[model samples]
Target: METQLRKGAHAVFNIQFHIIFVTKYRKSVINEAILSKLREVFSRVCEKRKCELVEFNGEDDHVHLLVDAHPDNNISQLISFLKSASSRIIRKEFEIYLKQFYWKKEDPSFWTDAYCIVSTGGAPLEVVKEYIKAQQKPKM
Candidate 1:
């Protein structure tokens, strides 16, 4: 699966990113307010970076973002831009829950520094989007 996923990614300059990252320590703070604000911040950041925000939705502990980032932009820079910009806004603007978890007591930050990135442009956009849109936590 990894090989099939990674194939053509090296040779082809075209690539899109479907990324998933979690809150620091997987804390559940991505409530309605934070999610809404994050939507706005991510939109602005993507516009600034010339990336496309396909979709972004989160539960409490984690987030999933489908990004159409150009090949010139790698996963790290994109995630960095999103995390930094969103975290700052979220930390200051909506601190009800974020305060105790990340903003106060030097908790390091809200989001964990780890992320998973995959190229979706290798497949048809529709197929890629379906996979992402269908993504959900494993059934109990």
Candidate 2:
């Protein structure tokens, strides 16, 4: 989701949140359909959450998203929302195998608890876009 640039804002700030989050091994396996759906769901979440998903990239293990959000939204809240919602969507939609830690009758874990974040302070949009585009898959 791309944010509309309205002119003459009292405080027009472009806040970018670079999210580096991953799924557990053998869970949310890397597949074309899964990846595509993940991106789609993520975009929709941003749209509903009033955020702009500027850029995204990933391999099988991890994903990188560049999000430009408004000041009223809290960083941790958005991160938690994105990670938890996407994880649930993936597991239920794909019926992927779940590790014991992620297995449950009520809810499952699609993403690991660990996550990385980089808040861009007054950085240009292009700069953030380039970094997200250039995010490489973690070597393991």
Candidate 3:
């Protein structure tokens, strides 16, 4: 994975996150064509947020993303946008195929409301803890 720092006007940072999105009711609705479309949609969303979609892949019921994000971004908003936009686009593009999985014809949802997001990169937690512990104590 690339660990290069990104520069903003007044900040230099390297923040990455691993995110997971599951289909509504964990339905196995994703096929090769859907996966391809997902990758395209996710890439565009990441770019729109000024983030890099470092890695993206999925199985039938779920998808995973590794995003290198800017500090200025609000992760929650980014995720909301990702889910909503992707869901709308996917449902529109593959309505006929998705119908079997999602029976409700009106406003069918693609992804579940819940998601998993974890910060990544830099040293391990224990290593960081030890480094902090080793710092010189302030004079009494």
Identify the runs in model 2 with alpha carbons over 4 angstroms from their true place.
1-10, 25-28, 96-107, 121-140
lDDT of each: 0.75, 0.76, 0.93
Model 1: per-residue lDDT, tens digit, 5-67?
A: 222345444455787878888888788877888888888998787677889888988878887
CA shift at 43, candidate 3, in angstroms? 0.6
Tens digits of per-residue lDDT, candidate 2, 1-140, equal 56455223466666777888887753546577777887888888888777878898788778889987876678888888888888888777777444433656565767778889987655467987998999998999
lDDT by residue (10-129, candidate 3, tens digit) is 999999999999999999999999999999999999999999999999999999999999898999999998999899999999998888889787756899999999999888989989
C-alpha RMSD for every candidate:
11.6, 11.4, 1.8
TM-score of each: 0.71, 0.71, 0.92
Candidate 2 clash total?
0
Best-performing candidate as measured by TM-score: 3
In TM-score terms, candidate 2 sits at 0.71
* Candidates by lDDT, descending order: 3, 2, 1
- Model 2 weakest lDDT span, ten residues long: 1-10
CA shift of 38, model 3, Å:
0.6
